[model samples]
Target: MIKEQGEGKSRYMPGLDGLRAISVLAVIAYHMNVSWAPGGLLGVAVFFTLSGYLITDQLVAQWQTAKRIDFAGFWMRRIRRLMPAMFVMLAVVGAWLLLFDPERLASLQGDFVSVSLYFNNWWLIFHQVSYFESFGPPSPLGHLWSIAIEEQFYLIWPILLTVLLRFTKQRGKLMMFILLGAAASTVAMAMIYVPGSDPSRVYYGTDTRAFALLIGAALAVAWPSRSLSAAISDKSRLVFDILGGAGLLAIVWLIWKTNEYDSLLYNGGLALFSVLTAVVTAVLAHPASRVAKAMGCRPLRWIGVRSYSLYLWHFPVIILMNPSGIADDVHAGRALVQIALSLLLAALSWTCIEEPIRRGFRSPFREKIQGWSPFQYRNKRAVSALALMLFLISGYSSLNADRPADPSPAIIDTSSNGQEGTTLPVTDPGIPAVVIPEAPIPMEPQPKSEESSKPATNAGITAIGDSVLLDAAPHLEKLLPGIMIDGKVGRQMYQALDVVDQLKAEGKLGDRIVIELGTNGAFSSKQLRELLSSLQDARKIVLINTRVPRKWQDTVNSTLEEVANEYANTEIMDWYSASKNKQTYFADDGVHLKREGAESYAFLLSKTLQGG
Candidate 1:
């Protein structure tokens, strides 16, 4: 710990700032859809752990010195530090929306309200929105949820810590209490989390995520001293070195190997990541640790100092600069421009807005004119004029354009009167006059081979999947007589295992099986192997791959291909390849099918079933 004097605080750790830099960069890379950082979103857990440690350390120091906590002052400090930059970003985004895309205003308005109130996570949960699921354009303010969690902790924790300090002088008891809370939160997460499904309920819940924060607080309670006597002994140093090395390796492994879709993530992955990060944090907190010195390099410290502003501005900049949606393939040139602009904005915000506000400068309205360097002041004036001109043009275009349309998700609608046909409509805000064709008439009975013509053919074939399978059910039934499709919205493969077992017990496990379960989320290779064993009695098995534009797409597809190659009874449908160029066949969500897509999909399956 470097005891640099800053505003009367004795403890300063530049290496911690380097950690912040790493965390925010990982998150930015993940949001950019960079292939190398699949688990980059875990950066949020790092931030959470850091927050817990820093905030707890401060509270404990205040208690030890002043023997009392200044709750009101602490709250005001946090609000002053965070809210000003947040409001600036929101105002800029709101103006951009009003000028260029008023259609998003309604949703943005709701998001702004929730964020301002520090309840954005609950609002997202209420709307059943999953952070990992990219269905449309990315929301600029989507990252605010983490800030909300931090603020929530800031609001409630000081009071709780004060009470604990007043009640018990024993640090051990307090640590025990915190451990209990962590245990409860972890259990709650494990209970609510469902593998291979939308994880919004657990991911966004404060109760479920509090464990990461608690882990940090526990470490703060046990933080080692920098004094020579308290310096790590040779044996203890070896232990720290091993734990630190293992923790760093684990984090790097997870970043490369895991993604949001992995089931292990829900089971225990996040908590494990937090624990490992805590171990690294302990090593970094000690000044004698060689790893700490390496992480405290000048560049990492500089980025760490500006990390907050970078995080606040990067996502909005990415969204605004991206003409194509976030989930689409990114142009390298555009991505580079986005990164450069985001960094520039962060630097400007740091110098012009954040520092001045923190230093109690005159109103920002006045500083806009006088506080900047002469070069910056002139550039700011020119930029302001240009912005005004563009805003007017955008406003005129928005007004003269047709009223904005609300985008609706595509849904399957089976025809009435017990028909075996499905039609899907793909809706977009633009092209209001776009018409979707009705379902194709059922296919006439095709000539059957000796094997296909067998009686009691209802027992010959069955298909199980999620809504993607539901979209193709009617077409499949029409093309292949007496085919059974058991598809439910949001169905997971684990649930499908039970369905298959029930079918087998009823003596209805068909001679052939088609499983299309990975669209919603990813399953482990072990799960896939178990599912295949359940269907081993079938003469032929079909695994339909997914083309959903989510992090899990490749994992699901690759797993299917690998398992299929190893099993003589199985083959993959290659839907990802078939659907690659057929963009018009998909809805705006880029997963479910339109009518023509369903027809193409059914035809492919029909041919594959016939050994084509």
Candidate 2:
């Protein structure tokens, strides 16, 4: 162990900041395009590790030197370090929501309150939030979800450590056991449950994420003495440097090759690889190691130093500047411009907002005030205000609820009652049957006993499609009265299928399955075939041929026609014909249906079902 002569000052580790820079950049790039960088989100795993190591190290050192941990002082320092910048960022994000999108303003308000109160992760988990979902990219503070996780860990880990130290006087072995147990449990859980579970739950659960942080904490607690560190010769250091580089490169490569479907496996692998790299890097932390010096480069270290601000700023910029309706447009030039803007904004926030507040909290005046009794310092007042804000936000969200429409709709067929044979609706109108088949014999009406089950008045409609299908739900429900209509919206058809299966299991699958997918999945014949296969159970499946705003009409129409031909149950709703060569149904957010268009679509859909 390196001895410190001073009371407050601590030795700075080399290359840690550079590693942070790499992680943050990977996250930004991954969010920008998961296709380009599959495992980019692993940056958060790296961050958790770094945070665990540093925070544990600080707390353990303080306990060792002082012989007693000053819990109040320790908590105060944490609040001062984390809260001010976080609150300021939340305030900014809140202001942005108010000015930009009023429809999503309620959710933003709720998220802001949760983030400020250090419960964003819990809120997100309960709500089943996914950062990549099409609820229009989340606020800039979406990144704060990880921060919430870390803070929550800090709350528990310290108390556990303090207790362990008080009793055992040996921290290293205890930490190792805890870390090993956590890692084993996490891996086991992921293997057994995550593969077959809801992606949202798997992505956001705290237990699923704890292993990454525990690994770092364990390393910090079990750090070897300087004598052991010195025993690592130049050859060993060189070998470690090579291994670390390979590990880092492998992580980046894996990210580019993976997708959201593979998140559990990718994250598990990355965490293990990262822990190994961290261990190797720690062993080679000497001044003579070129890898350490490279990782401590001036520019990279500078970016790493302000990584928190960059992480906070990047998502909001990408979300807010997104084109009206396109979810994933690969406009390299536009993205580059956005990236530049994000960097500028991050720099300004880091210098003008975060640094000033952080420095202020560390100043002599603030220290003197902090030394006062807890009540005199007014920390309770701040806590009370935060509580009130959270209450207000929750109340607001509850009051402004956008209740989902009934999932079932009454099926109307006036032409057929108890008939024998009926001509089923088919794509080829010329081959109309001469006889109309009778509806299935009505079950004998049992005496209306009190225990008798009521007839289903509304069988729910499942609208499976891209983002546009989501936007059409309200209009659809309005047009098809007494029937429940809900949308399973996603960027990929496979995601839509997943939701469809869930709805079926929940008994929300209606008599009619309406499909308006194809915008994104149209390019892939395999996806279209898969979607058709998934909808095989539906009594009636309606396919809306793609309509274009302008340039992509030909491409979208071609894809739609191909899909229509491949399925027997499919009937193409002529959206292309209805639009009359102009974009009618879509909103400025090109992928979502406009109100007028959705109403038109609902009318057409109702007519098609009624005619059948």
Candidate 3:
């Protein structure tokens, strides 16, 4: 009698899939910038819980039955289950990049290596990668950072658990202590460090994320046996279901309401929320919970079944369709299109790639115990060779790729001499004395005549933008000879506005404010409006519109034009159009100005300011 394929052991849990659906959907919505999914990133935490619980549950079951765990077999199973589909996805994406987005493709090779090697989190940390930087485009596999985190956890967690079990000699108690300690330590750390820590560090750190997984592990280890399961009455089960559903909703609500500013407290709350979910899931595994049955609804179960594929496909779809810089314009519409496309692609991937491979792994023919075990069947030499080849490909791409020059000033300023109300030349052979201007008279006291012979009191030009603007400063000063140009380089628009206000108060509101910004940054319309509006007193504010790659030019143009129209002092410098007509002005990066371009920009800007 062929043992009924899915008999005795309930390998299918609809609620777990429902939970996965929740996790993946939240992440997708968040990435799409849906107004309601503020905390969608917390979906990774949910996934951690599910992964910990399922893996630990399997391990505990094996341990109980066999009296020892086969670590090699377990890891081999993990590799086969995870790697094949991942490899296929990466290969497809790599090929796509080569055909359509070769420049971005070259940059993505490192990310491909990181994702394939399961080390993307470390790559991000080492590079200090910011999610907001206006690079030409982002990697298709940037979302793999979370996968890297999970894989990294698995590399150490199983060994740690095994060692702890050996020492404690009691699985339940050991997991209990680990769970309690993780939760307490995470909460404590969040309280202490999150207040001042960089938001990215807080978001990505394993220490803070461990508690969610531990909560799931705790449930698996401490699960009540069948005998005790009978003691939980129907009423208690109903209450657990209601409370668990409510808790899930509350967590979603919190995520929707919070932003990066509130992430510290919100993530802490998520830990508590995840723990509640684990408890509910563990208790509701019994056949009696109505809410659990509801979670097992056909649609949710299907979404959960395809969750991994959905997760993998959604981000790339969103990225490919929306592109960088375009997000502000088609953020909502592109998001919907991405979601629909992702679902279609996910369905195809699930039907053709993931399910087939997973099924093949579980096939009885593959499970046959030959003299060689599954671990031995895994060709270590082949795996190593593949890893090396991928690494080489990544290294080749990265070495060949053109990276930006480091912006840190090579020369340090050490001068002590102070000068007041002195105009410094751009071609300063040496660092000049710091000039302190006379006490600021009110703006009302200043004369407005364009030809007034009274010496111009303030700096003639003030350039503000990101690192790229720093390159334009010397030329700007040259064009406005002896005009005391005040350059606030490497600042975001809003931060630069603050500096502008301070300079205005100090009597440095120059006749012309040439903003050579846009490169190295992207801003929302609201943010750009606020920044432009703040420059109310400048006689002329020249917005040096950025010339981005063709893909992003339209977005840059639209945003700049909108902001310029809203402010009376603002006029777009049309750098994009100018650069097209004079290609020598742009650097190879296509964003920063070349030396000639900088000088040309300065010439045109000076003419504009002089009312020529």
Q: Judging by lDDT against the true structure, name the best candidate.
A: 1
Ranking by TM-score: 1, 3, 2
After superposition, candidate 3 runs with Cα above 4 Å error: 1-10, 132-135, 170-172, 180-198, 224-231, 283-286, 323-336, 361-452, 455-612
lDDT of 2 at 230: 41
Cα lDDT tens digits, model 1, 1-612, are 222112124466766777888888888888888899988889899989888877887777777778888887788777777889888878887887786777766657779998888989888877665687544566778888888888899999889888888997788888888878888888888889866556767888888899899988888777733321336578877776677667767777787677877766667778888888888898777766666667778778767767888999888777665544353456697678667667766666666666667656754533432212232554765654554454345334533343225544565322211123333323343433323334222222343576555553434788877778778877887678777777665566666788788777977577899898777666778778888988887899999999987677788888888888878999999899998889778865678888889999999998898789
Error at 481, model 1, angstroms: 3.4
Query: Which is the winner by lDDT between candidate 1 and candidate 3?
Result: 1
TM-score for predicted model 1 compared with the true structure: 0.82
> What C-alpha RMSD separates each model from the true structure?
6.1, 13.5, 11.5
Cα lDDT, model 3, residue 437: 28
lDDT of candidates 1 onward, in order: 0.72, 0.58, 0.59
Ranking by lDDT: 1, 3, 2
TM-score of 3: 0.63
lDDT of 2: 0.58
